[model samples]
Target: MNDPYDNCMAACDACAHAYDACTAAYLAERDAQALADCIALDIECAQLCRFASGAMARRSVLTPSVCALCAQACDLCAAECQRHAHDHCRRCALACEACAAMCRAVA
Candidate 1:
């Protein structure tokens, strides 16, 4: 069977990448609040991506809803990242955008 989890995994990868970038950026700039927010979102998105991927892989009925939530999270994360004009934020925005697309597709 073709893997539906492919998209989920992609989202997961993007989320994780974005999360790392945001964390690094926050740490570098010492923007504690932004760093905290990004980390929280990143953690949430990462877990969602992992769950969505695993659920999809197992053909769980909850995949769509989970993907939907992932989409929302990615969107928010992207918006937040876009506020800063740094490389890390740019990268995070891109990843979040990609993840959002993937999540929308799955959802």
Candidate 2:
């Protein structure tokens, strides 16, 4: 059966992937030290999105709570990413925004 939160799950998954890529790219940059906060938040947001996606997929009772947290994490991640001018950060920010919106819809 198709889960009601499938779309949100997909969005979360995409956001996780984007965050992962952005973090990796940032780590390789010359100013990696300056982006420490952004990298940390990206990793955290990715993990939260993954967890929320799993909870939603399983139709867990905690889905709402998890989704709400995921939205907040995604929002923060997006803001952090937006502070940088890198293409990867910009892309990740966009993905995070979309994921946050989807999570909010079901939160």
Candidate 3:
């Protein structure tokens, strides 16, 4: 009942929110400096996810290319988040992994 693009868009939107939340949580950590890469990747992944979702929503011709990039961002973010041991990081990693899978399929 759902289109692949629609599903991918939804996943991307969710992952963006997750990444944003993780970034905020990490910023409040005592060793935030150690999470610099994770935070950076979170921001990058969120931005890409938002862009990919927008492109898919409008059925843009470049959706596939955007999705491919989004997938890479999501994967890198997931890997970074997985290096941490916080609940927020775990949640974000899961979301990123799911979004990456969807992006790969959509691409």
- Candidate number achieving the greatest TM-score relative to the actual structure: 2
| Alpha-carbon RMSD, candidate 3 | 1.0
Query: Per-prediction RMSD in angstroms?
Result: 2.1, 1.2, 1.0
lDDT values, one for every candidate: 0.76, 0.93, 0.91
What does candidate 3's lDDT look like per residue over 32-90, in tens digits?
Answer: 89878788888888999999999998899999999999999888888888887889989
- Candidate 1: segments with Cα more than 4 A from true spot: none
Q: Which residue runs does candidate 2 get wrong by more than 4 Å?
A: none
Q: What clash pairs does model 3 have?
A: none
Q: Order candidates by lDDT, high to low.
A: 2, 3, 1
TM-score, each model? 0.81, 0.95, 0.94
**Cα deviation of 48, candidate 1, in Å:** 1.9
Task: Name the regions of candidate 3 deviating beyond 4 angstroms.
Answer: none
lDDT of 3 at 29: 88
Q: How close is candidate 1 to the true structure, as a TM-score?
A: 0.81
Q: Is candidate 1 or candidate 2 better by TM-score?
A: 2
